[model samples]
Target chain A: MTETVIQTRGLTKEFIRDEFHVVALDRVDIDIRKGEFVALMGPSGSGKSTLLHLIAAMDRPTDGEIRVLGQDLRGLSDREVSYWRNSHVGFIFQSFNLIPVLNAIENVELPLKLTTLTKKEQREHAATALKLVGLEERMRHLPRQLSGGQEQRVAIARAIVTDPDLILADEPTGNLDAASADEALNLLAKLNRDYGKTIVMVTHDPHAAGFATRVCHLEKGVLLESLQADGS
Target chain B: MMRISNFLPLVFKNSFRNRRRSILTVASLALSLCLLGLLMAMYEALFYGPDPTPAQAVRLVVRNKVSLAQPMPLSHEQKIRQVPGVEAVMLQQWFGGTYRDARDPNNFFARFAVQPQEVFSIFSEYSLPEAERQAFVRERTACVASRTLADKFGWKTGERITFVGDIFPVTVELKLAGIYDDPNQNEVLYFQWEYLRESLRPVFGGEMDMVSQFILKADSPESVPRISREVDEMFAVTPFQTKTESEQAFVLSFVSFLGNLKLFMLAIGGAVTFTILLVSANTLSMSVRERIREVGIMKTLGFTPGIILGTLLGEASLMSLTGGLIGCAFAWALCAMISSAPIPFAQLRGLALTPLITLICLSIAILIGLGSALLPALNASRRPILDSLGHSG
Candidate 1:
């Protein structure tokens, strides 16, 4: 039997702006099992990112339950949520947000700082993660010293350094050139296919969505359909 | 749940992220603290001089009742000597005169005509050889200067110096008999009272019989207050009324001539501190504002609000502490130079930057750092992660 990695039943999120209540996500239902590369497809402001945020425990839903890795996220305190998120989830951003001062290996080592790992062990784990992303040569380079694609690779190294159970990426390739974007998408696909890592990536690009095992479309705060990718 | 110690490297790196801004902020803090330290040192020296030694505690000064400018008749010294608890008595008259250059302030120091026979017995804190003391007492034209004063002017034994008197229309020449050392490094010169009395009598005749004040020592510390009262009462009905006080109180009264110095220094210090706080707050606010997205990134990586706030606060404290150390060192060096510059003000002769002053200044620097960063760090820590990530800065 396949285990469900993420389950959201009638999950809703609403934001209030200047005396008006705006609904970002309305009672959306989603189910993602282990080792599934699910791509959330939608236009801007379509709440696909909001669903990913809710599942990642980066935000709270207004009206339904969200459980990730069989743990009820709504029951966790802020501090508990932080520790749980650090241990269980890896997040990547579109802008390749690395701490400008730390080198590539140090950026990858940030997640392990919260653990009880010794400094040597943390460096060893970070170096391995960087090697996995093919950034072994750039371990001592700062973010500004790297190209956009190389910086994105460092971000990927940081995300997976903790050996998290699930990886969530929001517009991971939106700022990259075509060749860099393809390299990043190929990396995500390889992680899911070879390592059996569960990934939920948010993107408006259909070509990027094609790299996922399943595609779920969201429009106007509503989930339309979940379809398997043609290759899968 | 992160230990603050783990954040030190991050804190240190962030402080230098914008090197120019950090340096400017530290320089401003250092300058302000330097001024504050100097003012505090002066205040400490004036108000809290080292506690009186055992011999000093039993000594008293008798002056005119109304004002320091009023001269008391010489007969009061005999009556003061006869007091029950009085151990010894000496007369001292201030001779306000210039050395070589009357126009230059650096040529000024304390000069007094004192009873040379009683000088060593009355001021037991001073130390010199017995031969020098005997020469100073026997020769009416001889003068004794403290080692600090002698070093300032390069005067040696047998060197002749003349002073053109300012208060009395008379000029006197004297030979240097000895150089003595005192703990406070006071720049003072004392000459025989008979030299000044003879010089004055040729001009003002019998008016030269008057003297400025009398210094007396009691048999013990317990008898100081009683001796003061008895001496003052003995001269009450006479032509020369006397005001008697302990040696420490006498020095403090001279300091009072400058007005309330404590309040003055505190007011300036408070203003400077407030200005530095505002400057520091603004600089830290801009630094944190520029790093809003970075803070969000750290939060997504599992840094709690407490951790973020503590790290930023730590950065501020570390930067300000560096500035404080530099400022204290500057102030200490400046005070050393000033103390050796031959200033005539006795209150500032031995001004010093004590360890207690340095500790206090450093603590204030830390407090300033913490106070300046509180609002900005709190705001950054509590901001919603999504909003922070979305921030353009």
Candidate 2:
């Protein structure tokens, strides 16, 4: 059996708004194995992104336990948590959250700075990551100088440059056009298949979900069902 | 250990993220610091007058006990000279007069009726050629001008200068016998007290026998305070009582005429510091608030809270340090320029931004930078990553 990379038991998240208690995620239990591409599908405000954040340790669960890569997140200090996330997780956001001031190559080089890598080695690694995302020629351009597709590709390069064990992407193609969205989804699929990266992506588009090995549906903060993708 | 050096480039770039705002902020800091530096220099000048030379350190002045304008009887000079440590004594009087026009501040300088025979003996620091000294002593209708004063009025050794008196009723005339150099007393003209007395004798009916002040020197610096007290006590019961003090103390008493200047400078300095603090805080707050989303993005990229806080503080400090250096350099240049020109006021001649003042200004600037950004940086660092990522800005 492949090792379980992500495990949650009765995971819950709550928010208080204007003196009203709101449950963003309720009693969610899920397990993701190594090298699996899982797509979490839901309408807006359905807590899919909330669950992904919990797994990535970007947000804490209000109740229950979350264990990623055999380490219980609640047991770690904030500093240790940051080190863990940097070493083990790569996150891609919907808006292609590239630092506007940095050029494409510098953006990819951001995470490598946290390591002991020399400047030359960091540059070589970032270049390889960009080439993997098919953005090798656009490395010197600023985000404003790139198209939405190119910008998202640059963000993808930034995520994978660290060689993290798990990739968490939240609506990575929501802002891209049809062609760009297809290209981004294809890249995610290739990273999971060829690179053997365990990826958990949250998206509402069924077309994007079809590229994953397994699909899960979330509604009103509840995980309803999980099923294998027929073609994949 | 996380190295802040890794993020220095990011901090530098972020400092200039909004060029207009950054430039305006730096300009505001620079101007405020410049004004503050000048204020500190003024306080330094007034509170602590010029340092006395070895000659000046042993000299004392005797004036009327009640007020500086009141005259002391000339008879007191003999008793003062008889004191145990007294080396020499000279009769000195302020001759308030107009040269060309008293209305012009540029024409202002210290004009004194002094005992020419005894002046050099008492103020031994003044330097004059032996021939000029002989000429000055021989000719009773002769005066000596300081090198600075002669250069100001373009006066030569043989030129005759007349003073239209304001205190006495007669005009006095004298020839410039020589120019003397006294670095500590730059703007002054000293003439024979006997000539002034003769000019005033007809109006006062006699030798105008009262002196404005008597300047005396003690044999040693250590005995100056004792001699001052002894002189004042010797004339304690006389109708024209005397108040004696060292030259430095006399200069300080003159500065005290400006009211409680130390307290005033302190209040102004406090107000300026607070104002700059507020301005800096507002600027950093705005800059951080606008970058909330970006901070969250970095947090998501696994930057710790400490790193975030440090980076922002580093940016603020860099900006403020730049402003501080420019402001201090500007103040130093201004002081140098003013020192080159003639300062109408004697006490303000040596105004400058000392090294201590520069260090203090730079320290305040850095404190303002760090103090202003602390709260905003703390809040941004501690804010939840989810909310930061969800933020539109």
Candidate 3:
């Protein structure tokens, strides 16, 4: 039996702007299983990022509940949620949010600092993660010292350093050129395939979506349909 | 628990991100603290004795009851010595004069006339060579000068120096019989009372027996108050009544002429500290504002809010502590240099930076640093993750 990595039941999110009510996600029900690469696609303000944020436990739903790795996010305290995020999930941002002052390895080691791992173990894990992302040679370089694709690769290394079961990436290749975008997409695909890591990414690029095993389209706070990788 | 080793580098690097602003803030803080330290030293020098000698407690000064300007009769010295608790008495008269060839005409140094035989007995703190002490007592025109004063004027032991008196209308010359060294005393020229009295007799028509003040050494520190009371009461019936006080009180009374010196010092120090706090807090706020997104990223990476606050506070403390040390050391060096030089201000003659004062200033710097970071750290830690991440810079 494939374990459910994420489950969202009747999840709704609302925002109030200028005294007007805005519903970002309405009656959204979604599920992702272990080892599945799912892509969330939509136009601007269509609730794609909103749904991803809900699943990642970065934001709370107005109604219903979200369960990630069999743990209810709604029941967890803020501190527990932070600990859960550290142990179970990793994130890659659109802009490759790497700290400017830290080197590639130090940025990768950031998540590991929260764990009970010894300094040597953390260093080893960070080094291995950088190697997995093919950034071993650039491990000592700062973010400004790397190209766009290389910085994204470093961000990927940071995301995978703690060996998280779920990796949430929001437009990981949005700022990259075609070549760099392809490189980053290929890296993410490899992470899902070779490591059996479940990934849920939000992106507008069709090509980037094609790299995922399944693509879920959202429109006007509603999920339209999900397409399998085989187009079946 | 975040490891200190891991957190320190981040704090240090982030603090220097805006190099120009950080440097300017630190420089301003350093300059202010330095001025504060110097002012503290000045206050200590004025109200409390500059040199912390324990022997000063047993010493007493007998002055005219009305004011320092009023002189007392020389007969008071005999009556003061007859008191039961008085061990020794010396007549001291201020001789205000300018050296005949002084480079700066307005430059003033302490000059006094004292009884020759009582020099060593009264001021035992001054150490003079045995032969020089004997020679000073033998010659009527011989005088003794502090080593610092002798070095300043390039006067050898046998050299004769002339002074044109500003108060008394006379010119006098004396041979330098000895040079004494004492940390408690400043660079001064001391000549025989007989010489000053004889020089002034003809000008004043044989009525020059009055002296500025009398210094008395009590038999023991426990007897100082009793001796002071007895001496004051003895002169209560005379026309020239006397006011007797401990040496410390005498020095403090001189400082009182400036009016509430301690409060004045506290006001200046408080103003400087408050200004530094504001400047440091503003700088920290700006730095935190610029790094909102970075803070959000750290939070996403599983860093606790407490850790974020600690990191910011750590940066602030490091900056403040660095500035404080530099400022205090600078003030200490400046005070030392001024003390070694020929300054005419007697109150600041031996001004020094005591260890207690240095520690106080450094502690204040740390407090300032921590105090300045409180609001900024709290704001950064409590900011919503979504909002922080959404911030452009």
Q: DockQ, per-model, please?
A: 0.57, 0.64, 0.59
Find the candidate with the highest DockQ and give its number: 2
Q: Write the per-residue lDDT of candidate 1 for residues B112-214, one digit (tens) a residue.
A: 9999989889899999898998899999999999998898889998889899998988998999999998876888899988999889987886558788889
lDDT agreement with native, every candidate: 0.89, 0.89, 0.88
Residue B346 in model 2: shift from native, Å?
A: 4.4
Candidate 3 stretches greater than 4 Å from native:
B44-55, B78-82, B101-107, B127-135, B181-185, B233-241, B255-259, B344-350
Q: By TM-score, how accurate is candidate 2?
A: 0.96
Better of 1 and 2 by DockQ: 2
Write candidate 3's Cα lDDT for B246-311 as tens digits.
987887787777788789888999999999999998987888888989989988887778888889
Preferred candidate (DockQ higher): 1 or 3: 3
Candidate 3 interface RMSD, angstroms, 1 decimal: 1.6
Better of 2 and 3 by TM-score: 2
Candidate 1 has a TM-score of 0.95
TM-scores, in order shown? 0.95, 0.96, 0.93
